[model samples]
Target chain A: MAASATRADALVHARGLTKRFDKLVAVDAIDFDVQRGEAFGFLGPNGAGKTSTMRMIGCVSSPSGGELRVLGLDPVIDGPRIRARLGVVPQADTLDMELRVDENLLTYARYFDIPRDVARARTQELLEFVQLKDRAKDEVEPLSGGMKRRLTIARALVNEPGLLLLDEPTTGLDPQARHLVWDRLYRLKQQGVTIVLTTHYMDEAEQLCDRLVVMDKAKIVASGSPRSLIDQYSTREVLELRFPIDAAPALDGKLDGIAERVEVLPDRVLLYAHDGEAAASAVHQRGLRPESTLVRRSTLEDVFLRLTGRSLIE
Target chain B: MTGALRVVEHHLMVYRRTWKGGMFVSFASPILFLAAIGIGLGSLIARGPVHTVGGVSYLTFLAPGLLAATAMQTAFVETTYPVMAKIQWLRTYDGMLATPLTVRDVLGGEIGWLVIRLATTAFAFFLVMVLFGTVHSLVALLMIPVVVLNGLAFGAPIFAFTATQRKDKGFPTIGRFIITPLFLLGGVFFPIAQLPPIAQGIAWATPLAHSVVLSRSLAIGGMNPSALIDVAVLAAYATLGIIAASITLPRRLVR
Candidate 1:
């Protein structure tokens, strides 16, 4: 991409961007830079400032303290100018349910000052682009959840935005719906649109992100690619053992030397190891084979668990 | 404020699909009301000792007042729920803000659309008044602008108030307590002189009273120098409404 030659190859640059609402500090001082044509993900649990950061990047909210620059323009000074070239998918579906599917697209284009004919043509192309062409004449209220999401994505693409900021693009979607949304987003990334997304789903970050920053308690805890984060923070494999609750706590001592680290929970125990089969065999060698066991490769979820000391989903 | 007109343009597009729902209030309600009030109620008034009011038929005297009042009604209706829906329910304003539009542009588009709605419905009411032979002079054509002003006078403040609402329980009170009294007692059915002096003083402070006086004089043949006072009063209210909306809407939306 020609963006590599630009003066500021970073399309988004932030340093200590902070947002506070009264007594609560929603976003603590956090800094990150997103390069052009890169698909960056903010992976975090709720209340970790993912959505707040997205809003700041979208130019819809002002920073209470610190600096934020989108496309090299200060959001406070050039909000509208910067927003004209961006697309945002909010966490909730805010589609105009009263209008037909196509009207929502056309209305959005008008906000960018696109002429009527040009808007109509673009609306047509976008409806087809999101695979909602057949439902263009339908009311927005009745479309399925996934279809509504696709239509929103299409509406965002209507302006041909250089940067697309999606806040949990697949939060409420089913697995099938989530995959399709991810597919369309991947296609946009392949088309060279700079994309920044926020998600709590570690697999989503691993599946789609070229680079990711794990955020927690309003601060970034870890930042790197999925493999690098795992390699940096977690063992290559994890062994899971589920004993009856009465027997689970006592087995921790038996499996002490089997793996590098052990995580004890009420229902199961996680054994972090470089080789899962050898670790499970080590458990048997200690005469502690009273439960079921399984081995799996470490993922971003493990990396998150290692960093935050809490499960990603729970 | 660049691309502010697109906000109104966005509304116009939505109105194309949704205006039918509002037709009862905008077009049909006025015709039904004029027929019921001017023709039906005026017949009873004509039988009384004072058959003529202000040297004209009772129905003719009442037509301009109702037209101006209807303008206020339509403006209130257009500005209140639509603004509330955009801000709270439908979040259309949020949708616009996510684009290049700002909160001020959204407010401008909203108030601008309310003005057009007031004009269209007022024009429809004028035709209904003509059908009942309530229009007495050709200058009645100017009632459109006066009606638009009256609607804006009410719409602007309502927009300001509605933007600050988190729930809709207060909306019904506005219709019942504020708009209803203005419709009934703000000189819509009779001259404020018929009331006692204190009541008359209170009526003079209202936008509907000033709007009614301006509209009635414009519809009839005699609009004297005092009509300027009515214009100034109504214009002041409209300006206040705009100022208040600009302040409150951004405070509500930007947060």
Candidate 2:
């Protein structure tokens, strides 16, 4: 294929990729590139087509239209070849609950046609890498949610894939568990694994992603480094104001020009500005005192809300 | 070659770890059927003219038929629920597909495992039949491969069904609508000729009927040209079922 020349640097490349489910277009026409050994992310809310796009990249789902390549191979014709070089941690843990933790890793390694001795060695190494060496023999059904998630991550790493796909790696994890997973992922990144991940957590996006695309409703709204995205789409600081439901309108027209942008949410109003404390003081100077006020750095969450209106979509 | 061996190793691992419960059920059911039907129902038919191809007793005549039926039953049970679990509940196929193995390799591995399971169960049943003096001649040895073929006939179709099923609601329907009827009408308990002409014709169409006739004929040293026809029918069923399974498996899994 023509992709071989570019394969040296680009781990994943797509041109006008799109996926449609009958009448519903889950992933609209979009393009992106991921260089080797880079940590990339897809950040969006629920139903933002992140998982669908990941599935396409993982070679599990066929793209409806446009050009897509992974590891310099077409997914439709070379699925197994591409998939062999890819590791996937799906959004929902699809671990084999019937098997022991070690067995799960062993069985997964067998799929790669890895020799028994090699699979055994890799399973042991991965179990240690994910900190599940002690629970290796335990049945997966009895493992805690965090343990299972850790085991799933470990299983994905069994092949030592060149391109690792993690869809919401920290979702549903406790704070301690999330941090533990983050540490492992960071180590993998340092080891020169090219990671493509998707998460709704802004903190997770900021913590792991070297570059990201913010998706909303099946389309890319923006794409850049997290810092660059925040700088390009939003200001450096944010001032949060909380008002009584009845008194919110009294200050609405009074607080204009104090910040670069104002977003009114159900619980609070966010003011985007270069200086959060200055924006907060300006709000008070206009003879309007919110019930509570706090100033912090603007985040991807604010960027998402600014792009996609605040409506709870199913 | 390594791919096929990996599947075999996987099956062997699972069998060694889980077969205690399976062995208990496998031995118990056929023995209970032997006691209840062969002893309880055989007594009523023993007094009547014994339907012998070459001077075998009524219970002896019934034993080979039951063995083939049991092999098919075990194959169906193993291939259906476990196959469905691997596909849906367990997501084993998804995991396997992500590897270097193609969907055809998975199907080959599963069919290979079913053959081994059928052989093991048939061996155990053969021993039980021997203890009961069901062997009329050394010809009963040929019944082993016949029983394996019987398993493939049922296992292939069930495996194909399982590849398409998204839930377990249809499993009982397959048992009730297809398996149970075939068990009763397929001449497991009696000769097909005893049925009315139309029912006999319908019974002959089922793979179980062919299995019973072939196994019983061989058990009493009564092989004939029609045995070739029975073997051909079984081979046809197995080939078609396997091809259909291979074609359907990728469609289901790749989606």
Q: Estimate, for each residue in A1-314, the C-alpha lDDT of model 1 and write its tens digit.
A: 33234437788988899998888888999988888888999998888899989999999999999888899999999999999999989888789877899999998988898888999999999898888999989999888999999999998888999999999999988999999999999999999999999999988998899888999999999888888899999999999988876876566467767899998866778899999999988888888865699999998888888888887777
**Predicted candidate 2 versus true structure: per-residue lDDT over A212-245, tens digit per residue:** 9999889998888899888887899999999988
TM-score of each model's chain B: 0.95, 0.93
TM-scores of all predicted structures: 0.96, 0.94
> Interface root-mean-square deviation for each candidate?
0.9, 1.9
Cα-based lDDT at residue A49, candidate 1: 90
How many angstroms is residue B182 displaced in model 1 relative to the true structure, after the best TM-score fit?
1.7
True contacts kept of each: 0.83, 0.60
Q: For model 2 chain A, where is the 10-residue window of minimal lDDT?
A: A1-10
Q: Which digits, one per residue and each the tens of the lDDT, describe model 2 over residues B5-112?
A: 667667776676788988776677777878788877778776777544336566776788888888878877988888888888877777766666777778888999
lDDT of 1 at B221: 63
